[model samples]
Target: MKIELLAPTSAALPTLVVAAGERASVRFLEFFASAIRNPHTRRAYARAAGDFLAWCAGAGASSITAVQPLHVASWVELQTQTHSAPTVKQRLAAIRHLFDWLVTGQIVPHNPAASVRGPSHTTNKGKTPVLDATEARQLLDSIDVSTPIGLRDRALIALMVFSFARIGAALAMRGEDVYVQQRRLWVRLREKGGKTHAMPCHHTLEAYLHAYLEGTGIADDPRGPLFRTVARGTGQLSDTPLPQANAYAMVRRRAFVAGIGTKIGNHTFRATGITAYLKNGGTLENAAAMANHASTRTTQLYDRRRDEISLDEVERILV
Candidate 1:
């Protein structure tokens, strides 16, 4: 197979799998190319599978089919020493799923990773840093909306905060995704698993979105990306969509300018908004629905209300 076929993916075929012959190699590539729909997940699984197979080769496995549970377990044990439990667990899950796909294709006699157990992990709270309502407002207000970049940054941040949108879904939006529904602005987000979620824009988000679209003249191109890169040498929006890394840098810079001390990221706005909503009497059930989470349990990870309580108690020591 041409190496270019693997170019579209973030991972390359391991040499052991390549040595296993064309059928195994084809099946290995197909598992990532066909079975996974989400690009991030596909990239992660490919990397995990590639690493495990390479490790097996170093451990004297002749081919991909020769990998066994011991090799899988030993690799996982090594992973635990260097990575966080959640990350290790996710990597293990990636290996297990890939082996299952290989087994189904008859490339392997059995799933070697099926019985391997990952490190134990449990969490009631997520690790994402969250800004309080005051800081969120400060960050938004600090942007100089006289420029197209400022307007776009303010609107993008507000969209994530008010709508509880994941960064992926927020960045995927197009000009047409923001629309009028019942005399109010609404945003339609295409979330994970191809789920379509639409929410009426908060009054604040409505104003920001309106300013961004009209100010940048992006409203004229409804099919174009909503958040875009600034063209070189011109203070204008480019047709190229802003990448996630750029958005992250934008957030960090905006926070520093706004005097916010929290080390925030693209997901910070989502968690900040959820915690703010719950503190203001919004029910967990409603927050889950608004966030388009399949379960309230998943939504709980973003609730940082306990953070305030912990701070309050710490302040009482008065020492």
Candidate 2:
């Protein structure tokens, strides 16, 4: 399977030469290039795999073939000390997956990381900070929509909240993705694994999207990016899609201006919307479908409705 690849050094898998040898290095590159499709996951796994092999080199493990279960276990143990359980688990998974691919390619005799267990972790809730219904409204209303950038920001945030979209999926939108169907504005999101999800816009979302498109005058450019970065010093939307880091900065800036004390980020709106839906007589099953969650258990993580109930009961302690 020939795949386009960066040099091992460029891929952050620099130690492949010293630890994996020249022949084994090609297989290592293939592991990341072909096995992982998601860019975020590919970058993360590359970093994790690179860190592990670099550690192996420092410990005087001569080659990738020389790495054993003991080395893998020791590295994982050290990770658990400095990292969260989920992070350590993901790092361990990266190593195990890389080794599994190497073993299949005959570069390694066995998967050393397969025998090393990762840190244990379990949680019913996600850690993504969520705003309540009131805070969400305040933030949305606070945007100064006289400018094109303001309109874009409001629309992007509203898209995430209303559609329960992942930030990557929301930013991946093209102009044509937002369109009219059945006399209502509907959004088409190309979600993870390239799944196309379509949903009718919430009434508020319809207004925001319409205002953004009409105000920016980019509605006619259907093939262009739906959301774009403002040109430096020009205050006009550029052809480039907004980067996720820039979006995070924009969220922080907007939240500070709106007097919202809760630390929120791009994902906050998705959880906020899910919680609000569940509070208003929505079923968990339906919430899961709306959020495009593969399972209700995943959707449960975003449900913060129980948090309000707990707070209300706590307030009943009249001292």
User: Which candidate achieves the best lDDT against the true structure?
Assistant: 1
Q: How many clashes (backbone atoms < 3 Å, residues ≥3 apart in a chain or on different chains) does model 1 have?
A: 0
Show where candidate 1 strays beyond 4 Å: 1-12
Clashing pairs in 1: none
User: What lDDT score goes with residue 195 in model 1?
Assistant: 97
Which residue pairs of candidate 2 clash? 19-64
TM-scores for all candidates: the values are 0.96, 0.95
Candidate 1 worst ten-residue window by lDDT? 1-10
lDDT of 1 by residue, 1-319 (tens): 2223545322356877777777887887887778888888887877787778878989999988898999999999999999999989999999888889889989889998899899888899999999999999889999999999999999999999999999999999999999998999999999999999999999999999999999999999999999999999998999999999999999999999999988999999999999999999999999999999999999999999999899999999976
User: What is the C-alpha local distance difference test score of each model?
Assistant: 0.91, 0.89
